[model samples]
Target chain A: MDPSEVEFLAEKEVVKIIPNFSLDKIYLIGGDLGPFNPGLPVDVPVWLALNLKQRQKCRILPPEWMDVDKLEDVREMERKEESFTPPPSPYYMELTKLLLNHASDNIPKADEIRTLVKDIWDTRIAKLRLSADSFISQQEAHAKLDNLTLMEINTTRSFLLDSLNCMFKLRSNMQPGSGTGKALDY
Target chain B: MDSQSYLPVPPGVGMEENFLSLDDILLSHERLPSRTECLFPRLGYLEKTSDSQDIMEGTKMELPLWLAKGLYERKRRVVSVELPKVYREGWRTVFSADPTVVDLHKMGPYYYGLGSQMLHFDSPENPEIAQALLQTFIGRFRRTMDSSQNAYNEDTSALVDRLDCLERVLFRMGQSGLNSFQGWEKGRASHLTTSALVLNYRKRKMADLQA
Candidate 1:
């Protein structure tokens, strides 16, 4: 697997243990994992976190930024911003998707978080589409952007690049003497 | 000219006629040899022995970005990735001079894409470095175009106009460096056993050589 895939998994929510029996510290190739106790919470990779949750050995703590109120605030901010706001984490969107799919049972207010994240995503996408429209209409040859998260850029890349490339062709063709020098130009 | 034969074939059809396709540009760019020192501990998955290293922790070994990224992500303790020499020097030049006068394409099409991807994840604090560089570059680029006092003949000016259009497209495209490795491309590579085959077949082929 690509390292990014592994890193994405590593950045997920830390799992909290609700231990039934005592366990010794376990070591893995990556690093020492735990001296797991009855009520201690430790950050863990998503794969291990999900495994522990399934075995009833641990309860996962949703990331601090994953709360319903926080997400709603982010959604509102995105709707109002002229440009993108930096996401809480570079992998915020992906982390949300992973947790929702694999550990929803452990999350507090999973449904609301889902909705809020969706709203934020939809609003930002709508903003991107609007900016693209204005760009084409105004025939501004260049775009200036800041604060876009990695995920937002990924979602808009195809549409943005395709439109810009199309505009490039349009601008070039509209030039005089396009086809046959003085007599013709394509 | 026959009016009946006139057809709107669109303009700028020849814009890239003499230039390499995006895919080709990426392929040749990938062929360049480079290396970087790893500043963290990383695990290595050995394909042949199928035996993996528990950790490669050090600043001693120099490796490519693909390998370095894997190790870095597994346990960022494994290796620290650095900006390669070509780009480091290129930026030094851009920063020291009027960015507008610098040719954005001097480093090649893959410069922004590869540079941003390597830096963003590995060096989180500077994720926006690529965009900042491009913003300055385009600012100056546009300024030069606006200030030109009929610097070239009509033919040359037309070519310059086309180049301006191309530069913008590339700059914007470069902003989303990681996009090239994600989405449709990722989907294609998901079939791990066949991905190598797919890549080989995807390369451009030229035929018809006569002595």
Candidate 2:
């Protein structure tokens, strides 16, 4: 699929999962301040979908017009900033755990679960645009559970685990050091 | 020598009706100095009652004179200030010359000033009259409760309970007073009449908001 098409699909996927998600903003990190270099790897925008606590849960997207074959070179560009430990992607870690847990249960409601996860991600993205202060720790994320009704608590837990599992599986499928490679080891 | 052996009435000491009308009771010079004095008799009455009871019962309940004077003066001022706005123009025009009289009309809305008499008045002999006096207190308590925004809080709940107790005491007094005179009915009728005034105030506020 075209990189733009993939980004668009990913954005849609995020909204489909999380209710009350807005798509006006996405966070981007690590890129050269020059013209697009088709010869060398182009930069990618790291999309972190977050919940109210700003805990993120989505994969990074390559810059516009970049081909998949250039995915290897794109990964190298990201590695330069990899040393800084781009604040543990609360987005990826959370969503991946949720999806993985859901998939393990062999639940038929995986699609429903995915939708809520996406809604949360989209909300996070919208919040980031409105607020740079995105990303919350697990403790803060769990604290949010207190505010949820009893029913929401149970459903959200399962949904979160399922999303996390799916992200992990997607990471394993992609080649190492590829554009959509595994998130930071931590 | 038994108290129960005594006849209902000693023929010579007949009970004379002191049938004071609302105007007579409130405006009488015999019990009070005048209309202005009647507006704040609770201040002096409380002092005298406290001192006499202290001497007879061997316990001082009388507040210090300075404090008593300060409280009475403050209460009088509050009543004098509010009475004019609350009372009809005609009622106030009568006492317009006397600033103290005008003050009484101005502070009429704060009937709680008289209601505060519960803080000091403690005559066990006139328990019936004392209970009737509590009606003014209960009225003030209810007004304060309804006017406050956060009446649901713990502190407010305690205050409300105290107010309710005062109301119950007043109701008991009303029941007892009914045996003597039909006048208690008129006083009871006027208790919640101020609610209409408050409702009108609220409507005006809403109109102002829309404007």
Worst 10 residues of 2 chain B by lDDT: B9-18
Instruction: For model 1, give the TM-score of chain B.
Output: 0.39
Model 1 TM-score relative to the real fold: 0.43
Candidate 2's residue-wise lDDT over B30-81, tens digit each? Answer: 1111112223333444545453322332222433212332233423331111
lDDT (Cα, 0-100) at A15 in candidate 2: 16
- List model 2 lDDT by residue over A114-186, tens digit each: 4444444334323322221111111122222222222122212322333233223222222223321111221
Candidate of highest DockQ: 1
Q: What fnat does each of the candidate structures reach? A: 0.00, 0.00
* Model 2: per-residue Cα lDDT at residue A77: 37
DockQ measured for candidate 1? 0.01
Candidate 2 docking quality: incorrect, acceptable, medium or high: incorrect
Q: Per-model i-RMS in Å? A: 16.8, 38.7
Q: How accurate is candidate 2 locally (lDDT)?
A: 0.27
**Residue A92 error, candidate 1, Å:** 2.6
Say which candidate scores most in TM-score.
Answer: 1
